[model samples]
Target: MRWFLTVLGVLFGITVFLFLDYALPSRQTVRITNTYNRLTDIGANAIFYASADAGTVQNAAGQRDVRFIDTVRPNGRPYVYRNEDTGWIWPPYFKYDSSNLHAQATDRKSTSANPEWVSVTSYGWRVSWLSIYPNAISIRSVAGPDVRPFNWPAVLILLVLGVLLFMLWRMWNQFHERSIEPAIRSADEAWDRIDAQADAARDRARGRVSRWWDWVRGR
Candidate 1:
């Protein structure tokens, strides 16, 4: 049972970590290479995108014109981001400026020769197998390609979560120490008393049997 609980706890922790990692905003410094609109089906990857009522018109076949921004890192690795309005949905970016972000990405487009670097703030993972792209929340031009902007939002969120977990841990320890431990100890003591009574009764019964047998044998 202990091993089972340990495995269950580990799985729950991993699930929460992955959910936060996906929901939290992250920054990437890359050069915008191109921007375009594509009619995407969304298909099974609809969860990765915003809701249907997020101002983007969707057809009966679940197809919509999705704006995509193509970018490349300083090391020449390519990345793609979907420009979409999150509206008042999960992740709580409340972004309703997809067109503006797309325009900004288009204006920031640069070639390798000139290389205009920009920091694109987004959330989610780009899973190629699932045809998932990170949704870009905002964009801004940066000084250079090697610029690493500090993610203050992520740090503050983590700190708050840490404090909350610490408080919960303290409460649990107190409960275990005050309530659960005492109850368990009482149960153990009750069992010990019952065992002692049973042993004494058995010894008394055996002594009576021995005395009766000796009297019947005329000793």
Candidate 2:
């Protein structure tokens, strides 16, 4: 049981880490290679894409227009992102600036050699097997690829999340120590008292009943 519990705890921690890593917005300073509209077929891969814009219609159709930003990382690696409005869904990006972001990306486009570096803040991941790409939330021009952007947003989010988790831990500890442990202890004491009473009653009736050795042994 101890081994099983330790394994379960490790798995849960890894799962939470991966979840936050993908859901939280991260900033990357890279050079925009290009930007364009991708007529994507959204079948089972719809969850990877964002919902329709606030006023846009969300049809049951299999295809939709998704904008993509192609860029090369600071370490000279290519990165492709799908731009879409989150439409008040998971991750709570509330990003409704698809067109405006596209324009900004287009304006910031530069070559790999010259590298007009920009900081792109985005959330989500690119799973090549699932054909899903990260959604770029915002972008701004930076000095160069080597310039590291200070992630105050991520820091603030972590602080809030840490405080929430700490509060939850405290609540769980209080509930267990006050309620669960006391309940279990009371139950154990009650059972012990009942057992003692039964034993006493058996002793008191032993002489009142006429029983030979054979009867006592249940002949």
Instruction: Give per-model TM-scores.
Output: 0.87, 0.87
lDDT of 1 at 58: 88
lDDT of 2 by residue, 123-166 (tens): 88988889989899999988777888988888899999999999
Off by over 4 Å in 1: 1-6, 53-57, 211-219
lDDT of 2: 0.86
Q: Name the candidate that leads on lDDT.
A: 1
The deviation in Å at residue 127 for candidate 1 is 1.4
What is the TM-score (0 to 1) of candidate 1? 0.87
